[model samples]
Target: MDQLEFAYPWAFILLPLPVLVYWFVPAYRSREDAIKVPFFTEILRALNETPKVAAGLLSPKHWQRGMLILSWMLIVSALAKPSILGEVQTREDFGRDVLMLVDLSGSMDEADFTTADGSTLTRLNAAKNVLKTFIAKRSGDRFGLILFGDAAFIQTPFTADQQVWLSLLEEAQTGMAGQSTHLGDAIGLGIKVFEQNPQPSEQQVMIVLTDGNDTGSFVEPVDAAKIAAARGIKIYTIAMGDPTHVGEQPMDMEVVQRVSQLTQARAFIAIDQAELDKAYQLIDKLEPQQYSSASFRPKITLHYYLIAIVLALHLLIFSWMTLRQMFSRAEVANE
Candidate 1:
C-alpha cells in the first residue's frame, strides 16, 4: 500500500486571496451620469413610489459565498498536484548454470531400482522421477539437458524454464541414441553448450547420470573432463547401476570418479531411488541457487480527479440555480 502526497504544497497560499481582498480592497461603487429627465417626477408618481439616491453594495447569499470559496479551494488543491507513492517490488536473478548429461544406453532399461512403495522401475525412469523433484526445488537456476548413447546430442539447450526441460526429459527413452554409452562425447557436448551460451559471473556445473562404462567414444571421457576443468566447469558424476555386474553392462566406477576428481567435483553410486535422490540433494547443497531483487516506489499524479470533482460541483450549483429561476418565473406567471 501507498500514501497520498502533494507535489506543490505552496499552491495552498492562494486560498486566502479572496479573504484578503475582502479585508482591504474598497467596495465597488460607480455613479450614474446625471442627465435631467423632464418627466422623472411624473414617472415616479405613476409607479406610486418615492426614490432615494444614496445606496450600499449588495452582497451574495451565504450559500453562494460558501460554494465560491469551496470551488476556489478545490482549484488550489488541484494546482498542488496530489499524488501517491507506490510500493516496493522484487525479482529473481540467476547465479548458476547446471547442464545435465543423462545416459540413454540399453543398460539403462534394466528395472532393478525400487521405489518407496516397493515397486521396481528402470534406471532412466527412476532418474527422471528424482530429477523432477530436483528441478522443482532448484529455483533461479538455468538447466541444460544432454542425452548420449552411441553418439551425443543436446536434448534441450540451457534455459530457465524448468517445466519445459522436464517435459523434454520425459520424452527420453532407453536406446533412443543407440545402446553403447558415449559418456565422453556427452561431456564434450555439455562443455560446448556452456561455451556457446556463457553467462558472466555464473558458476557452470555438469551432472552426469550414467549406467555403464563407455564402450567407445570419439573422445575419451577423461580427456573431456580435462577440457571441462580447463574451462572452469564443475562435473558431478552419479553411477546409477550395479557396480558388481561384469561383462557388457559393467558399471565403470573409476571413470566416473576420475571425471569428478578432474573437475574438482564429487562422485556418487546410486543403486536405488533413495540414494539417487540423496545424490541430487547433495549436489543442490554444493551449488545452491540464489536470487537477487530490486525495489522502487512509483509516483502517480491525482490532480485530474480533484479537477473533475470541482467541475461536477460547479455544474450541480448551476443546474440548481437554473431550476430555481425557472420555477420562480412560473409562479409569477400564475399569479
Candidate 2:
C-alpha cells in the first residue's frame, strides 16, 4: 500500500472560514410582505395568524448552515490535494544486445541432425527448438534476429520481448529469401543493426549459424568480421554440418573459425542436434545477462472523491431552495 500525501497542505487554512462566518455574521432577515387582496379576505387572515419564527442559533435553518459548513470543509480538503504514493520499484537496464544471425538458405533443410529419441529433424528445426529455449532464459537481455539466404533480412528488430522474437523466428521458412547462402551480408547487416543502436562494446554480440559457406555475398566474411571486431562486436560462428561431406554445398568450418577468431570469439562445430545444444549452453554460460536498474515510485490522487461529495451537497441544497421558492410562489398566488 502507498502512503498518503498532499501537494498543497496549506489549503487547510480556509477550512474554518465557514464556521467563523456562521458565528460572527447575522442571519438573513425575512421581510414581511404587505399586499392587499380585495376578493380574498382569507389571505389577510392567513398572513396575520402565521407564527413569526425567527431564524437564529436554534432555528431549523441551522441544519442547512451546518451542511454548508461541511461542504466548505470538503472543498478545502480537495484543495489540499490528498494523494497516495506507491513504493519504489527497481527495473534492470539490460547490459547486453545479442543479434542472432540464422542461415535460411535451402541447405538448412538438411535432416542430418537427430534428437535424443532417434527422431531426425531438419537442421533449422533443431536450431529453432534449442534457440527458443535459449532466448527465453536470457533475462534482462535484448535480442534481435536476422535471416539470410542469398541475401540478408532483419526478421525481427532488437527487442526485449522474447515472445515477439520467437514468433518471428517460427514464421521464417527455409530458403524464403533465396537458395544460396550470403553469410557475409548477414554479418554486415548485423553490424549495421548494432551501429543503429550503439551500445557498449562488451555488451554487443553476434551469433552466426550456418551449415554451408558463403555462396553469393557482396561483402567478404573476413572483412565483415574485421569491421564487427573494430566496433567491439564479438562474433560466435557455428558450422552446422559435417566438413567431409562432398557436394555442391559444403560446410566450411575453417572460414567460420577464422571469422570467429578475427572478432576475438570462439568457433564451434555442431554435426548433430546434441552438439548444437551444447554449443548454445556454453555461449549462455559465457555471456550471462548482466544489468543495472534504477528505482522509482508512483502516485495516485484522492482529492476527487472529496470534491464530488461537495458538489453533491451543493446540488441538494440548490434543489431544496428551488422547491421552497416554487411552493412559496404557489401560496402567494392562491392567497
Candidate 3:
C-alpha cells in the first residue's frame, strides 16, 4: 500500500499521445471570414463594435477545452494500470523430509512383541503401529518408505499425503523383499534415494528399523553411514530384537551405534514394544521441528480512482453545456 506501481508499465507510452497530437495537427480553417457591408456606414459598426472573431477567442469555451484535456489525461492514467503494493510478510513452514528404512526380513515375522492391550503382535506389526503414530505427529513433513531383506527396494517414494503413506506401510508383508537382512544395502539404497532429490543435510533424515545384522551387502554398514554423514543426511538406527539369545537373525548393537554416531544421531536397542516406542520418542525429541520462511507482498489496483476522476470531469462539462443551452433558449423565448 505504501508504493504505487503499474501492472503494465509500458502502457504509460500512451500518456503523451494527446499532447503530441495537439502539437502536430493543424488548426481548423473556415471557408468564409467576413460579411458584406452594403451601406458602408458607421451605423453597421455601431451595431456590433466588437470584432466577432476576437469575441469568440475570449469566450468561456476555452475553459471547457482545458477541462477536456484534463479528462483525457485522467483516462490515459487509468489505462496505465496503477496499483499499490504492501509490505512483504514471511510465512514460516516447519517440516522435515523423512525416509524410513524398515527391515522386512523373515525374522521380523517373530511375534515376540506385545501391544499395550496385552495382545500379541509380530515385530513388523509392532513397528508399523509405532511408526503410524510417529508419522501422524509429523503433519506437514514429507515421508518415504524403503523395505529391505536380502535385497533393498523402495516401497514408497517421497510423499506428503499421510493417508497414502500409511496405506503403503500397512501393505508391507514379511519376506516381501527377501528372507535375509541386508542392512548395509538398505542404508546405501536410502542414501541413493535421498541423493536423487537431495535437500539440505539438516532437512533430511533416515530412520532404520531392523531386527537383525547385515547378512549380505554390496556396501559395508559403517562405510555407508560415513557417506550419509558427508552428505549431511542424519541416520537414526534402531536394533529391534533380543541381543541375549542366538537366533537366525541376531541384533548387532555395535554397527548400529557406529552408524548413529557418525551421522550425529542416536542408536537405540529396542528389545520389546515399549522400548521401541521409547526409541522413536527419543528420535522425535532429538530431531527438532525445522522451520523455513517465505516472504510475499500483496498488491491492490488503484486505476478505478483515476477512471472516476475522468468521469466526473466529463459530467461537469456536459452539465455546464446543457445549462448554457437552456439559458439561450429562454432568452430567445423572451425576445
Candidate 2 wrong stretches, greater than 4 Å? 1-14, 17-64, 85-95, 114-120, 139-142, 158-164, 192-202, 226-232, 244-255, 261-264, 291-297, 304-335
**Which should have the higher lDDT, number 1 or number 3?**
1
Query: Which is the better candidate, 2 or 3, if ranked by TM-score?
Result: 3
Instruction: Write the residue-wise lDDT of candidate 2 on 261-318 in tens digits.
Output: 9988889988888999999999998888786789887787889999998888889888
Model 1 alpha-carbon miss at residue 306, Å: 23
20-86 in candidate 3: lDDT tens per residue?
Answer: 8879985555545466676645755778665445212234377777877777777777887888887
Worst 10 residues of 3 by lDDT: 51-60
Q: What order do candidates take by TM-score, descending?
A: 3, 2, 1
Model 3 error, position 208 (Å): 0.3
Looking at model 1, which ten-residue stretch has the lowest summed lDDT?
Answer: 241-250
Count clashes in each candidate, considering only residues at least 3 apart in sequence or on different chains.
0, 0, 2
Off by over 4 Å in 3: 1-75, 83-94, 198-201, 291-335
Better of 1 and 3 by TM-score: 3
Candidate 2, number of clashes: 0
lDDT of each: 0.88, 0.85, 0.84
> Candidate 1 on 1-335: residue-level lDDT in tens?
36888889999999999999999998988777345798988988999988767656888999988888888988999999989886665555787888999999888898999988999999999999999999998878889999999988999998889989999999999889998888898999988899899563369999999988888888899999999999999999999867777215667788889999999999999999999999999999988878565677779888898889889998998999999999999999999
Tell me the alpha-carbon RMSD of every candidate.
Answer: 7.8, 7.4, 9.1
Among these predictions, the greatest TM-score belongs to 3
